[model samples]
Each structure stands twice: as C-alpha cells, then as structure tokens.
Target: MGTYETAATLDFVVDAVPGLSSTTLGWILVILAAAFEFLGVIGLKKYSEHKTLFNGFIYLLGFGGAFAWLYFSFEYLQVSVAYAVWIGIGTAGAVIINMLFFGESKSVGRIASVLLIVIGVVGLKFVS
Candidate 1:
C-alpha cells in the first residue's frame, strides 16, 4: 500500500460513521463538486481565449463542493474506504454529470470504463 492507503487504513478504525443527515449531505456535496468540476473543465476549454465570470464561479463552486466532501469523507468516513469510494463514486458520478450537463455520449466505450472502475472498487477488499 502507498502512503495514502496506509494513512487511510490507520484512520478507518478511529473515525465514526457520520449520521444520516451528514451522509446524505456529504453525497450531495460530492455530486455537486463533481458536476461543477466538469463544468469548470468544459468552461476552461470554451473560455480559453477570455475568462468569464460564470467560469470563475464554476471553479469556485467546484472547489467548494469538493472541499466540503473531502472534509467529511476524510474526517467522518476515514481514509481507506473514503479514498477508494471517492475516486470510484466521483468518477461514476462524473460520467453521469457529463451526460446531463454536456449531453456527452455514454456509449459502450464510456460505459465500459465506468464498469471497470466499479470492478476495481469491488476488488479493493481483496487487497486490503
């Protein structure tokens, strides 16, 4: 395991599972973060020549959402599961968010990637 994995493992037993309200709010935060981040990336491409106020707001919202999720994910959920779930969940969420916001195609190519990511998350138990 890497340093992050190690530290996350160390934290797993120490942190408490957040309450229902917090967990619900945490997931919303993560999803919002992922959505805004995607928007920010797309905005970056679209507004490359000239920065726009909306683009800046997207970046700020993205960071804010991610910050909130990271705080709860690490402090409340602990590292190992939180880190793994963060990537997997965020990645999956990103795919859907892209579809929603940009009308991005979720063809077999993209679907496969999401499934593989899901498999990887499931496989983490074997390693840990």
Candidate 2:
C-alpha cells in the first residue's frame, strides 16, 4: 500500500481501539521497537559467540522489525521526538538486558546511568 493508505489504515486501527489515539499508538510502537532492539542485541551477542544461521536470523528479524515499527511511529509523531525516544529506550533496554542475562556489570553506577536515560526520555515526553 501507499504511504497515504497505510497512514489511513493506521488511523482507523487506532480509532477502533478504545481510548487509543494516534499519539498513544505511536508511543506503543516506540516501545515495541525497543523490545525488538533487545532481541537484536541478544542475537548479536549470540552470533558473536557462535556463527549460526538461527542467530543471524534473529539478528536480522529483530533489527528489521524494530526499524519498521519505528518508521510507523513517525507517522504519528515528530521525527526528532520519535527517534530520541527510540534510542533512549533501546539503549537502556540493551544495558539492562546485558546486565541481567549476559553477566555484564550490575553496578549501582550503571543502574543510575540507565535511570538517567529514562529520566531524559520522560522529560522529552513532557516537553513535547
């Protein structure tokens, strides 16, 4: 479908869901994108450890889907805001996931740093 048609369909979908607006849907997409980013990061780590088709598939699917969702979000949000939020969520998620599953450092400073990123995202949301 063309961009216009896709956008119209997205609007319809958002309107069909109770209490879900375009902006809210956009934020949801941003979060979804970030989730996929976690998978991508994990896949990357795994691929580095072992050269396997499955890991390569995971890496491609995760990053590709993440970017697709992020693209959809831009339909309802400003590019700058959506990008910043996406990056913030992805960065924080990757760090936490690494710490939790990959045996990365879970230092207080590291957690605090993630918290700072979260705070920045929230601040951007409030201002925009």
Best by TM-score: 2
Winner by lDDT:
2
Please give the range of 10 consecutive residues that has the lowest summed lDDT in model 1.
5-14
Candidate 2 per-residue C-alpha lDDT over 72-124 given as tens digits, one digit per residue, 9 for 90 to 100: 88898898999999999899999999999999999999999999999999998
lDDT of 1 by residue, 7-108 (tens): 322233234544444444444444554555565555554455467888766656665666555655454444565567566766776686677666889799
Q: List the residue pairs that clash in candidate 2.
A: none
**Weakest 10 consecutive residues of candidate 2 by summed lDDT:** 1-10
* Colliding residue pairs in candidate 1: none
In the order shown, the candidates' Cα RMSDs to the true structure are 7.3, 2.7
Error of 1 at 110 (Å): 1.2
Candidate 1 structure lDDT: 0.59
Clashes of 2: 0
